[model samples]
Target: ELSMSGGALRTFSRCVTCLARIGSDLVFQAYPDKLELHTLNSSRSAFASVSLTRDFFDHFHLPADAYADAAPSSTPLQCSVLLKSVLAVLRTPTSAIDRLNASLPNPQASKLEFVIHCVSGRKKTHRISCSAESDVQTLALDRNGFPSRLAIRPRDLTRLLSNFQSSLQELTVIATEPAARLPGVDDGTGGKAVELLSYIDPTKDDYDSRLHTQLWIDPAEEFLEYEHAGDPVDVTFGVKELKGIFNIL
Candidate 1:
């Protein structure tokens, strides 16, 4: 059993919904201190995770008492649900929700329930069927190994993307010490990607439009939030998935 504030639920739902856009299944793993939802793209090129601690919720309960010998935090109760089903429940307007309760009587049960407690005491329980297949394993990002990194605010991204043409599906991240490419590797798209990076070279006029956030990170300075060691790296992703992620942010 679990109860989270309406705001927390909305935030969690939005984040998870975005993750769902990148993958088909949402894997929820609960520990004593936190809950985590992990998802990975089919190509395994893109992955995102949301971790919420007990402090993030008003109340959190784990049925560990039912099993005397069961390991607590070490043994996480995990279950996978279809992305669309989860998204459907989250699509409801947040103003109507006051709190949320999620539970799994049996970790191996075929379904899980999410009860939305509304401000007016009107509640709705959504039963989402659990998947029998094992959850997809995600690749651990080696931040220390990535040579290049970029930081931008959500609002900045939203504004920048607003200028994007509808026909643009993929964007290239061009990095450079001497002219590099973003998504340095190929994504599924066959056409050249629309350049989404311009901060690598400060001399370029488009640099401001691309990295207008003014939060660019250089290899010389140690980034407290991120660790990297290598050469400039570029990556690509679908704009649709990016938009979903941005919306959650």
Candidate 2:
């Protein structure tokens, strides 16, 4: 059982909405110190997780018997629920919500209960059915493993992407040294910059006619932290996933 109020409740709502946009299923892992929510895209190529410490909740509890039979290395109590169903219960505006209390009677329980307290002194209850047999998926990538890293505000990146067509599906990011010149830009200044481009297959019949867009970004000014220790690299990924993550920010 756990209760969240004020800013914590608001954060929880935003996290759920983000997860809903990423996948069809929401996985919940409850531990003694924190609560974690995760989701994996249908293709299993993308995974996202949000962890909230005990301090984030107004009240949190874990029964001693929740995992009594498990070894010390056993996993936490985990369950999966339909993202749409969870979203339905959390769709209420955060301003109208004063508090949210969630409870799972036991590991064998088939339903998760949520009680919402509104500022008007009104209470609303919702029960979302969940399954405990669903397989858990996790990723083990290390952040330090990447030779290049950049930290930029979400709004900054989102504004840059706005230049592309709304229907654009993929985006390519090219990182290069300060002396390296980008495709179209001929500015002589040897300044560090990152290139963002809308990508479509070159072999497509309408390739030449399709809109081509690119944006040059000065990393020194836009990124809070930028580091590249290897050769130039370009990565392409779905823009829809990025928009989903930016929405929460």
Candidate 3:
């Protein structure tokens, strides 16, 4: 059983929604001191994972009998649950809950129960059935190995995204060592690292046509740093999905 404030529940629900975007079925792993949720996209191109510590909740309990055997330390309790089912119960108004207690009956339990304690002394209980079995791919990103890094504030990226049409798909991020250009929007200065966000559109009339929107970010001013020793580091991502992922983060 896990008991926590309403705010923590809401935050956790939001995290679940983020992984739900990748897929419906999710694998939740409960360790002695932490909980992990993870999912992967259909194409296996995107993955999301969240790790929660005991400190995240007001009270956390794992009954010794809940484990399949006495040696639970060697095997954490793992369960499969549908994201939609869990979200349906957790999407309640935050104000309606004073606190909540969630419990997994046992390692083989078929459902998880959440007891909502309302401020008015009214109690509500909700249960989301567990799935028979499922699998989730583990995503391991080596951020330290990423040669180029862009540190633009969230608001700035959101504002920039607002300018592009919804049909705009791919966003390419490039780190440049500055190039010669007019002293207008893209005045590039040498020795200064410049980051560029390019909205790719194959429908444009000409390849060189300036119909695409390009936003130049001054890396020095933004404190964006790179550790790569060679050419510019470039990476591309789907703007639509990335926006949702970043917003959740």
Candidate 4:
């Protein structure tokens, strides 16, 4: 799942290209999502809206004349607009999909679906049939067998874990010198990256500037699957190793 923000066609275009370059399974989002904001001075405030690049660009495309102008910050996003954009992008021209297909392992089999299962004041039990083959690829993210593991009511434990993980990443970035490029490594896309980083504050003076990077390595966990077998579990993050990475070990 990606949580990048932008309001121009170029900005979003670059992000979509990146997501396509990397093998992302699904794009998850919330309606009227609140954004966390911090200025260069590090003070914070928040604004609520339907947040995603696709929604922004589809409605607010950057014209050649307005290429360098600042993007819209005053306009609050519309939920219906986002829904429309989502539908359109899912059915994006096959030629576009094929352009990024080379970067993916099995782009043809990939399915990007919006999960709309609501459990409001209802008791229901969902079931999955056993696989045709006894051994099958079973990928379960945020699997809570019971309610006890949740973070108060419907708030997913996995979402909380992810936010916590993000905090860890920020802390790791803050600690590294020459600045941390340790987390997200640009895929070295043969210089056609479009050079737009999402999650970055474009209003800042450093919009065109490059950065110091960080990349975290998990020897045991591969993409979409952990090497471990059996019930789903949370991995204990290595803080001591993190300390070592920042030279405090």
Candidate 5:
């Protein structure tokens, strides 16, 4: 069982909406110390997870022997439900919701129950059908393994992305060091920059008339933190996923 205060309920709603935009199903993994929500895109290329500590909830409860004598590799209680179903229960604005109570009840339960207490002295309950899942699908990634890192405000990045056409599907980001290209020719103003370019396969039949766009950004001005310690590199990914994630932020 889990209960969230008004503030936490707001955050939880946003998290659910964000996850819904990323994937079709939401996975719940309950542990003694925290609750985790995870989702993977249909193509299995994009995966996202959010962890909420016990303290984040107004009330959190689990059986004392939930993990008793369990091996280190033992899996936690896991289940999945359609993202849209969860969204239906959370469609009410946070301002109208005073508190949220959720419960799995037991391992055999086929539905997850959510009770929402409204600020206007009303109560609503929703039962979302769920299915037991054998395990959670997650990607193991080491952040430090990447030589380049940039931290920018979500709004800042969103503003930059706005320069592209709405129909554009993919984007390529190129990171470069101006000084590396020409050692002696490097001007005092030489610094790191990134080029955001709209991408479309040239092999496509209509490529000849497709619009091509490029925008250059200086990290020093746009990013709160920027570090790069290797050769220039470029990565291309779908823009729709990025826009969806940022929208929730």
Candidate 6:
């Protein structure tokens, strides 16, 4: 309480309504000796997907919006519209990929593009994060909250999306290997100017932290060549499992 520690260790939780949307209750807590996160969920299981993601951004305060609405027994932050997009971008990944290892000229960045019909079955939401590129790239987030497995790998994307119209979808990421603080290691941004986004914590701030990695993609021209050059045999987007991941948060 503010009166208990002179505001040094004050915490509280409550339920709230936003934009006419009746949301679940929220939780809040603060401690002087350490940083604490407050999360409020109607059900204990409701927050499983958001817990790790909240901590990921809290370290950087990317949205830094009110952590949550006051919930009767939940921890919640009233996040900004921009911050709300964070969760949709962090969900499970599906690889609709059909090909990889094609050749093309190397530019300042790499590009990847694909599309899922999301047809004939259960529609699920997907969240994604990708590398920055010469042109800003965008990952898709399903409007609904439910997420299916990421169906495409950066490589298979070439084959899977090959059937779709070229103008329908695309992704580009700058493959910059930034400069390393160490004597001979590269930083991985490829010596390009890095944008100063405060929400993105640098490697030095938390040395042991694992950074978000982007998929390596080649130019669009090479993949596009498959379009006009062949039959619809190269691309295949199907119900398949993608390996090499721990778990989707």
Best by lDDT: 2
lDDT of each: 0.68, 0.83, 0.72, 0.26, 0.82, 0.24
lDDT: which is higher, 1 or 3? 3
Score residue 10 of candidate 3 by CA lDDT. Answer: 78
Error of 5 at 225 (Å): 2.9
**TM-score of the candidate numbered 2?**
0.82
TM-score head-to-head 5 vs 6, winner? 5
Candidate 6 TM-score versus the reference: 0.18
lDDT of 6 by residue, 61-175 (tens): 2122333334323332221122123223222222321111111111211321112222244334332222322010111235354221122344555453344333322222222
> Which candidate has the highest TM-score of all?
5
Per-residue error for 248 in candidate 5, Å, reads: 1.8
Q: State the displacement of the C-alpha of residue 7, model 4, in Å, after optimal TM-score superposition.
A: 7.1
Better lDDT candidate (1, 5): 5
The deviation in Å at residue 134 for candidate 2 is: 5.3
Write down the RMSD of candidate 4 (Cα, Å): 23.5
lDDT of 5 by residue, 122-150 (tens): 99999988954523444456788987888
Ranking by lDDT: 2, 5, 3, 1, 4, 6
Clashing pairs in 4: 180-213, 181-212, 181-213, 181-214, 182-213, 182-214, 182-215, 183-214
Poorest lDDT segment (10 consecutive residues) of candidate 1: 214-223
User: Rank order by TM-score, top first?
Assistant: 5, 2, 3, 1, 4, 6
Off by over 4 Å in 5: 69-76, 107-109, 132-138, 176-182, 186-189
Off by over 4 Å in 1: 65-75, 134-150, 159-166, 174-227
Model 1 Cα lDDT, one tens digit per residue, 95-114: 88898788888766888999
The local distance difference test score of model 2 is 0.83
